[model samples]
Every structure is written in C-alpha cells, then in structure tokens.
Target: MKQKSENQKAFPRFLGILVVASLIGGVLGGLSGVAGYFWEDHTAFGAAFAHLLGAASPWAMAACAAVLLGLGLYQYRKSDTAFHGWDGEDEDVMQRAEERLSWALLLDSLTVIVSFFFFNAGTAKLPQSSDGNTITLLVIFLVVIALATLLQQKTVDLTKKMNPEKRGSVYDMKFQERWWESCDEAERRQIGQASYKAYVTVSRFCPYCWGVLLLGNMVFHYGILPSAVVLVIWAVLSVSYTREAIRLGRRGQKTE
Candidate 1:
C-alpha cells in the first residue's frame, strides 16, 4: 500500500520535471532559431565577448588576487591562533583554512592564466597598438604572475605551520610528489577521497560543457577546439582513474 502511495505521489513530481524540461527546451529552441537567423553574417556578438574579457581581464585578476590575499591570510591567522581551548576545534579550523586557501590559490592561478591569455591575444595586434598600452598590459601580466606565486607560497607555508606533519616546499619542483609521500595513511585516504570527488564532478560537468560549447559553436562559430579540449580532459581523467583502479586491484590480489 505504501509503495502504491509513493508511486502515485512520484507522478506529480515527475510530471512537473518533465514540464519544466519541456519549457526550457522550447525556450532554447525558439531563441536558437532566432540566433541562427541572425548568425549568418554577424559574428560581432561572439568576437565581442573575447575582446571584452581581454580588456577587463587585468581588473578581474586584480580583484581575485585581492581576495586571495586578504581572506586567505585572515583564515590562516584564524586557524593558526592557539586560543581554541577545550573542544579542540583547532583541527577543524586548520582544515577549513586549508580548504579555503587551496581554493584561493586555484582561483588566483585561474585569474593569472586568464590575464596572460588576454595579454597574449592583445599582443597579436601589438603593431597597431600604442607601445605604452602594450607595455602596461605586459607589466600587469608579469605582476599577476608574481602575485599569484606569492599567494600560493603563503598558503603552503601557512598550511605547513598549522599542520607540521605536512612537508614539501612550494618552490620545490617535486613538491606534490614529496607531499603525497609524506602523508600518513589517514591523510592519504582523505586526499584520495577528495580526488575521487573532483573526478566525479568533472565527469558529470563535462557533458554540460559539451552542450554549451555546441550551442556556442552554432551561434558564434567558435569552432570545435574548445569542445575537443574538454573531451581530451575527460578522456585523460577516465583513463588515469581506470588505470589506477586496475593497478590497485592487482596489488590487492598479490599477497606481498
């Protein structure tokens, strides 16, 4: 009886979702039709986006860097403080700080890369551009790189301070490898779990990116390179995960 009741209740939610999907599909189809009609000779809309991002890339990066430094340092200090007393929430504080700082590093790196991209793109027309303007962009790009490196090193050093068990210098070429080797079993397990979660997220998000890229191509003719890059990333992730899983399975069976 409960199963039947649950099935009956599920139909309304299912139908609602179906209706919502249909509405979205209908809207997209209608807009795509209009876009296709206008897309014939006018690619201004598409090319304009890159130009705009390129123009604003430095400012975007500056904002990200500011947050990366300010909030990151605050969190690090909060976690590093010794006054957490009885409950021993220090571990939690450190973990939270580490996670936020890691994200800040990632965000800052992305901004630096984006700024570099725009700088490179803008340089293609350097002959047409004033030397002063070109020099400014170049200087900003260099500063962005230097700032990103500083924030990354600070995050790593503060992380090490909070967790003395952590090892490896941020400047070391084999830092990641050394850090992984230094992790104890529990830390290694946590790292593995986080990696697996990231893998799963990227795997799921790839399809949405594919769909967006397809739409962009249809409307703006950005070509297939973006989609191909996403495919390559997905393929690498899947292959590496599978290879590691198989290797671990084999190792488990060998009574070494």
Candidate 2:
C-alpha cells in the first residue's frame, strides 16, 4: 500500500515540476523576445549581448555535452554492479534510473535542437571579419551532435537493460512472450494500469501546451522551427501511446 501511494504521488510531483518549468521558460522566453525587439532602438546592449552569446555559445554547448556524456558513461559503467542483487529496492532504483535517463534523453535532444537555433542566431550576428568564430561555432555544433548521439544510445541501452520486457519491437516477440509468461494476472493488470495512467496523462496535457507554444512561436516569428517539429513528434507519440493505453486499460478492466 505504501508503495502504491508513493507511485501515485510520483505522478503529481512530476506534473508539478513540469508545470513550474514550463511557466518559468515561458516567462523568460517572453522577456528575452521583448528585450530583443527593443534592443536596436534603445541601446547597444542587444548587439553586445549577441556578441557575447556568439562568443560563449560554443563553450556552453561543449560543456553541456560533456556533462551529459559523463553522466551517460557513469550510468553505463555503474548499472551492472548496481543491479547485481536485484530485489524490490533494486527494482525501485532501476525504475528511478530509467525515468531519469528517459528525461535526460528528452531534455538533451531538445537542447541539441535549441543549440542549432542558437548557433544560427549567433552566426547571423557575427561580423564578416570573424570567419574563425563561425568555424569554431560549427565545430562546436558537430561535437554537440556527436555527444548527443552517444548519450542517446547509452540511455537507450540502459533503459532496455532495466526494462527489457517493456521494449516495443515486433522482432522481440519471443522475449515479450517469455516476460509475459513470467508475470501473473495481477502483475499484468498492475503494469497495464500504470502504463495506461502514464500515457493518458501525457496525451492529455502535453499536446495542449505544445500547441500553444507552436502557435505562439509562429505568430511571433520566434524562429523556433525545431519546436514545431518536436510538437508534431509529441503529437504522434501521444496518439500512439493513447491507443496503447486504452488497449491496456480495457484488458485490465476485463481481468478485474
């Protein structure tokens, strides 16, 4: 019962954090846009800021990529020993690691996309004499992309190891069947219910905010095209998961 309660609490906590982050991002983005719009007429601050950004962006991106790479390497190296004696506590630890890695993958992917935009914006602001700066920025972009790819693969591998039974691939039928055979009806129902809740929550909430952000960017000419692409991806994933969640929910209900 306590575990179930904690599981229920986790959803609300996740939602709250997401909401707070979204609100903060929205406010900061709005303020930056406003400041940028007025920058030309009011002060030299805009140009200076752009110059600083162009100078700093490469280092910033490289640092972020390095941190992600370090984390991924650490996780990959430690995961085996961490799960050596799999018990309920180990299961919980694995679940937490899975969740953290999933979020890391999502956020890091988005960061890479944002870095592209930042690179473009910075290069546009650069003077023609600074050809070297442009090359440096390009190199940083490539390095960040490489790091992001490595981190993503590492996270996926870790997630698969932690939850091999949950992997969704037609070729994995044998493994899936074996996993299902290992679980009793009650365990299956619990899994189904949990999956249904997670998918439904994301499908219900994520698309609405994404749509708002997409429309806002388009109308304001924010040049966040990657966001639009991400929105579409999110919509597709939400729909796919919603269908699966419904199927799982129905199965759980029938079993009940």
Candidate 3:
C-alpha cells in the first residue's frame, strides 16, 4: 500500500473534493435560491414582480439573512485551515491572509443582513403610497454589494501581493517558459506549496458567494423563475467540490 503524506493526512482526497463540490454547490444553490425568489414573486399568481424588483424591505431582509446563514455555515466549517497544516517562514503570512479573508467574509455577510433588516423595519414603521423607500433601499443594496466586492477583491489581491510567486493556475505557470525560468528554487517551492494548500482549502466559496448575491439581485429585477432545477443540480455539485479538493491533495502527494 502507498504511504500517505502529511498533505494527505491534513486534507484527505475525498474530503478535498467534497469542499470543491460544496463551492460549486454553494454557487448553484445561491443562484437557484435567487431564481426561486424571482419565480415566487413574478409568476402569474406570484407576488408582484415590481415589489420584488424594487426590493421591498422585508424580502430584502430575508434574502440577506439567507446568504449570511449559508455562507456563515460554510466558513465556520472550513476556517480551521489557518492552523491545520504547513509551517515555516511564509506560514504567518498565509495564516494572516486566511484570517483576514474569513473576517472580511463575515463582515460582508453580517452587514448585508443588518442593512436588510434596517431597511425593512423602517419601511414598515412609516406608511407610504409610493415605493420610494424600497427603491432607495435597493440602490443602497447595490452600492453595498459593489463595495463588498471591492473589499474582497482587495483582500485576495493582498494575498497575491504577499505571495507574488504563487499567482494563476498551475497550467499557466508550467506553460510559460519565461515566467518559470525567472523562478528560483526556493521561490518555486514556496509557490508550489502555497498553490497546493490553496487547492486544499476550499474553506470559503468567495466566487459562489458573490454569484449568489448577484443572482438575488437578478431575481428581484427579472421576477422570472429562470430555473428551479439549479438546486438539485447543486446538491450534487457540493459533493463534487469536496471530491476535487481531495483529489488535488492526493495528486500533490504523488508529486512529492
């Protein structure tokens, strides 16, 4: 039997893939949830499309809460990676980045929920003939999403800056002769390890998180179901993400 290495011990092949699958699933489920909201709001007998599109306060609050809850669960489960494996000079930098990213995600999620609740509660307190309140709140929501995106983007960029040698896909590094040549042995090893660790930590699905937020906005805007099957599809996707993480861990060990 083949001996499993440290990487394998920390991130089993099956579990890694499960995380990846969860990333994909999270993205798809978010999209599906958004679509479902739209369908319910705009179908023939559905809730008024304009009300949703305008992001009536209560609904917005609910949507925000859903996102927070889903992503919060994901992060809570995977946040241990900052200390799970790896050690050496660059380890501190890696851990700091991981923690920073986690907090950022948490902040974004919480802010969204709070904002939604505030907007809805205010709307309910004061009676109004026009939907000025709702529209104003939607605009605010858009701005918040944009700002959140920038913050996350900056956080990811910081990680890249701190670890300059480990950007882009493995294929990109391998195919580019000039870039590969520029790397010294130490740099190469650092890059390789960092890249592999990242593959192992599907700890948070940032892309999917954002995608779901966008989907929510779309649902409110379009008010069309688009598709209901996305949920079922993503249920399977979660498993696939987990599998991919695990497979990458296994592959890294083989290379060692």
Candidate 4:
C-alpha cells in the first residue's frame, strides 16, 4: 500500500498551488498599478489615486512608506527568533502552520495588487516628496520583502520536517513532555505561561509583519491612507493568525 504520509495530500498541495497563483497575480496587478500611477500628470487617473489614499500629498505616502518598511524589518527579526523554541515533535505542526502562513502571505500580496488597480485613477498629479517612480519602487520593495519572508519561513518549515531528529531542539520536547505529564496547578501555570509567551511572541510579530504588508496595500489603495486603517487591519489579521496558532499549539499539547 502507498504510504499516506508520503502522498501529496489534497489540502496542503492545493493550498500551496493557490499561494503561488495569488503571488503571481498580485505582482502582475501591482505592475499595472505602477504604470497607471505614473501614467501622466493632470490625468483623471492621477486625480483618483489622490482621492483613494485619502491624502493629496505624495509626501504623506513617502513618510508612511518609510515607517512601514522599518517596522517590517524589525518584525522580521523578532519572528525569526520566536520559533527557535520549538523542537522535534513539534516540527510537523510548525511546518503545517508555516505552510498555511505562506498561503495567507500570498493572498495578501494579491490583495495589495488588486487595491492598486482599484485606485488606478484620480490622485494628485505631482507627488509631495518624491516622484512616481520612487513611490512605485517602494511599493515593489514591500512586495519583495513579503515574498522573501514567506519563502524563508516555508523553507525552514520544510527543512525541519525533513530532518526532525538531526536539527531538532531538545528543549521543545522536554517542555511539551513535562507540560503533558502534570496538569497540576503549578504545571497549569507553567503551561499557561509558556502558551501565553509563545502566543504573544508569534502573535505580536506576525501581525506587525502582516500589518506592514497591509500598509503596502493601503498605500496602493489610498495613496496616503490613514495609519488607523492599517492598524485596524493588522489587528484583525493578527487575531485570525493567533487563533490558528493557538489551535495548533493546543493540538500539540494533546499529542505530546
């Protein structure tokens, strides 16, 4: 009989394909937006873009762009370090979590692209701080970062899954084992503490990373959309991803 584990199971495989498609679609759509954004001065399209970002000044876009990018980098570092705590048995769960995250990242990329096209027309003809090329380039940079991080996470997931014993951390196994054995008051407290810390670490950094992502989309959408909107979206996505990680973490708790 064929091994079920070795088989390319439908859901994960399907999700993987969808993720790739979404990323491709978003990149293409974003390019169109860049073209339209720089299409011409005093055109109807330019006027509309100004209306979308909610700021007529291009300098506003520039400022937010810098902030978003800076925050994105910081969040990336934090996320990178957060997962180092998980060990061998937790590897499969983490891999699945990361695979799901990859799909979400791709969807976000596509959303950013679609938002750009939605605001293709009707922004200010003249940018406040920099030229259209500069702003468009910044948007591209955001896309690059999103793509890179997702790829890195996915690769790490695959590597861990492939060599769980060799690369695995002993601490993760001991933590899980101990947590499972004693469900007593002190143990409960330790479990709660570990769960909370893990959740917060993942939840905080993941959303910031995703927030920076949405900010890119917002930039495409509003030209200078409110920072409030960006934060709001960040909160929503963070909650969603957090719920997912918690569910996985709990499952891991049970299995061990």
- Top model by TM-score, which number? 1
Selected candidate, larger TM-score, 3 vs 4: 3
In candidate 2, where is summed lDDT lowest over 10 consecutive residues?
164-173
* Model 2, span 48-159: residue lDDT tens: 7767877787777777666756665565555545554557565677765665675666656776776777687658765665767678889888877777766766665565
TM-score of each: 0.74, 0.48, 0.33, 0.25
Clashes (backbone N, CA, C under 3 Å), per candidate, total 0, 0, 20, 17
Preferred candidate (TM-score higher): 2 or 4: 2
lDDT of 1 at 144: 71
Runs in model 1 lying further than 4 Å from the true structure: 1-30, 45-49, 81-132
Task: Residues 1-256, candidate 4: write the lDDT tens digits.
Answer: 3576657566698899789967876785676567546554336765565554544333443444345434443443443443555564666655554544444444434444443432332133335544555466456545644554454445444435543532422235464454355355674677668767765776566545554545455334544354465566667767876787799899999999
Question: How far off is residue 120 in model 4, in Å?
Answer: 4.8
Where model 4 places Cα greater than 4 Å from the true spot, the runs are: 1-83, 107-256
Residue 34, candidate 3: Cα error in Å is 31
Once superposed on the true structure, which residue ranges of model 2 sit more than 4 Å away at CA? 1-40, 72-80, 84-90, 126-130, 165-256
Error of 2 at 118 (Å): 3.1
- Give the RMSD in angstroms, all C-alphas superposed, for model 4: 18.6
Predicted model with the maximum lDDT = 1
Show model 3 residue runs off by greater than 4 Å: 1-94, 109-130, 168-234, 238-256
